[model samples]
Target chain A: MIILIIIGMSLVTMIPRVIPAFVIEKMQFRPWVNRWLSAIPYAALGALIFPGILSVNPDKSQIGLLGGIVAVILAYIGLNVVLVVIGAIITVYFLSL
Target chain B: MTDKAEIYSSTAVHMIKRGFITGIPIMLGYLPVAITYGVLAKQAGMTLMELTLMSVMVFAGASQFMGVNMIAVGTGTLEIIIATFVLNFRHFIMSLSFMNQLRELKLKWKIPLSLGLTDESFAVSSINKDEAKMEKGAFFYGTIISIAYLSWIIGSFLGGVLGDVIPDRLSQSMGIALYAMFIGLLIPSIKKEKKIAVIALFAMLIHALCIQLGMSTGWAIVAGTIIGGMSGIYLLKEDVA
Candidate 1:
């Protein structure tokens, strides 16, 4: 049962990731379609961060929020991604303590 | 070998080196999250082999996390698979844009290259200034994805082995790491195009509203992404091509 689940999961996941490469290459999208596709990364980044970030520490959701804020500030100030992540981890650690 | 062929090969070598080096930060970013996934999946009763297989086969952090959580609660396999599909459907868009960006490459590279199109890999490849111009750009992009992919697998394996040794508070704190990385990746883009900030903000609002109405996180993100991208079609005037 577990193995079946894993295989099923892999199929669904890989299909979305792989099919576009084979299909999209042969097709030509209009300007608006390309615009929508181009915007997806930013949209994905936004959706990935919010709501999920707050719930990372469900018991004290503020810890996640504070960490997110620290990350934003550090990233805004042009810190390298590694440092920004480290800074957020430190903030969350201290807050959780 | 002809002089031009030698020059092309050397440039390809250079780009491959650059790709691996550029992947370092993403590797760093993936380690903690991958470890977290390992630990959580283990606690959820997954055997070491199962967790590792999931990491290797699925190769998606967020969906793997959700899959394990569902498994822990004894959710049906179909439900879990459906959720995984919805959560990962965003990759279709990413893959489309990514292939278009590297259209200079042959079709043969796109299949394997698309397999590695995670959020972090896609973002880095898309933002790279020299991506379109490099010789063997597929190999360069593949190297970047390969480094990050190796880190994920290694980190998950280590986490499975070292599960009980890691402190609870520290692992919990690591939960914030992936989100931090996302912000880091997004900020530079937002800085360049202030309109991107609006797109991000709008997506967040839509996601929040979806959650308020009792949508699953997976579906909500899809909703937010589609709606947000549509908003961009109007907000962004520049030609994407």
Candidate 2:
């Protein structure tokens, strides 16, 4: 039963990825589809990053917001990636104290 | 001398080199996170071998951490598996892009390579403009798996042996590494277009609203994806028009 559940779950997980591969290999995408496909990754990344920036706590407080601001500001100015993160973490740590 | 054999050998070398270079940050970050995963797995009564295999076969970082945490908290297998599935859904989107670009490789190579595609590998590989497609794929995929495999091994070993000594404060600090990496990626994209800035701001607003409304993390991700994706499509259309 456990094996069957794993297999079932894997199939569901794998099919979404595999379908597009078959589609792309077999057919020429419409121009709009191509553009949309290109946008998917950047969009997906934005989705992931924003929430992380907003709340380190369940209450959605000011510290995470402030830290995010510092991080985004530094990131926009072409600061080092490691530095931007260090700055954000420091901002959060200090604000919490 | 067969040219194909030479190409294959060179590709292997490139893969290992790229793997090591791109994996440095991940190596730093993974030690803590993977160890956390291991400790939680052990606390949940998972044998060392079971923990190691999970790391080997399913090297996803966040999901594994959450899975073991859930197990430690006495969650059922069904819930643990479901949460893991939800967390890894992003890989489907990533894999599609990789597959389309990797038209040169056979399924044998592509299958395992696709499984190894993580955010770190995707970020590094997608940025490289000059490498040959198959070689880049091999390199990027190898880079991801090599670090991931090592982290899992070392993390589990450390957790199994020294689980009691690690401080919670240090374990929590690992989260900062991800934010730092994001800042790195964002800076370049921000320079490229005003539209990217707008999309990022828009996504952040939606994320804030989701948090304010008390949405769960999973739902927040869904909301952000929809808002960001729609805004990207809109912005691109405006630019073209």
Candidate 3:
């Protein structure tokens, strides 16, 4: 049963990812559609970070928020991406203590 | 002929090395999150094989986390698969945009490249300005994806092996690392084009609203991305079109 579940999950997950590469290159989208598609990465990044971060530590959401804030500051200061993540982790670690 | 061959191989090697260097940040970001996923999946009663296989096969962080959570609660197989699909639907959009961005590459490379199109790689690739100019652009991109993929597998395997040995507080804290990476990636873009900030804000608002209404996290992210992306049609300047 578990093996079946894993296989099913892999199929569904890979299908969406794999199909677009082969199909979309042949077609051309309208200008506005192109613009919308280009905007997706930014939007997805936003959606991925919020609400989910707060709930990272459901019992102490502040830890996550503070860590996010530190990340923003570090990134705004033009720190390296690895350093930004490490900075947030350190903040969360101390806060959780 | 020998000189040309030597030059070609050296360029490929250089691009591959550069790709590995560029992927270091993503590898760092994925490590903690992947480890956390491993630990939680173990606690959720997944055997080590099941836990590792899921990461190896799915290769998606958020969906994998959700899959394990759902499995732990004994969710039906169909439900888990559907949820995984919904959560991962963004990859479809990202893949299209990514392929379009790198349309100059050969079709053969694009197919394999799409398999590694996670959020982290997509962001890095999109932001990278020099890919088109490189002699082996597709290979460079492929190397970036390969390093991230390898790190995820290694981190998850390590997490499973070191599950109980690691303290609880540390693993919980590592949860913030991925979010931080996202912010780090998004901010530079936001700084360049203020309109991107609006798009991001719109996504955050919609995602929060969906969660407040008790929608699943997978659907919420999809809703937020689509709706937020739609807002760009109006808010984005004509220059972008």
For each candidate in turn, the TM-score is 0.92, 0.77, 0.92
CA lDDT, candidate 1, residue B149: 86
Poorest stretch of ten by lDDT in candidate 2 chain B: B123-132
Better of 2 and 3 by lDDT: 3
Residues A1-97 of candidate 3: C-alpha lDDT, one tens digit per residue: 8788889889888888888788776888877887887788888898989988998789988888999999999999999888998899899998888
| Decoy 3 TM-score against native | 0.92
Better of 1 and 3 by DockQ: 3
Which candidate number would show the highest DockQ if scored against the true structure? 3
Q: Give the TM-score of chain B in candidate 3.
A: 0.88
Model 1 stretches astray by more than 4 angstroms: B239-241
TM-score of chain B of each: 0.89, 0.78, 0.88
TM-score ranking of the models = 3, 1, 2
Clashing pairs in 1: none
- Candidate 2 on B1-241: residue-level lDDT in tens? 6898898878788777865766665566567667777787788777777677666656666666676677667666687677767766667766665665564666655666666655555544443323435554666555665776687578876786677556665455445556556556655775776676676667667766887898766556556655665676657663331
Model 2 score (lDDT): 0.62
Could you tell me the interface RMSD of model 3? 1.6
lDDT per residue for candidate 3 within B76-160, as digits (tens), equals: 9999999889888888888877887777787888888898888888877766646755678887899999988999998888888
Worst 10 residues of 3 chain B by lDDT: B125-134
- Put down candidate 1 lDDT per residue, B1-241, tens digits, no spaces: 6998999888889888988877877887788778878888899998999999988898999889999999999999999999899888878777877877776777788888889888888877776736666667777898898988899998888878888555888878888877888898899888988999999999999999999999877788888888987888987776543
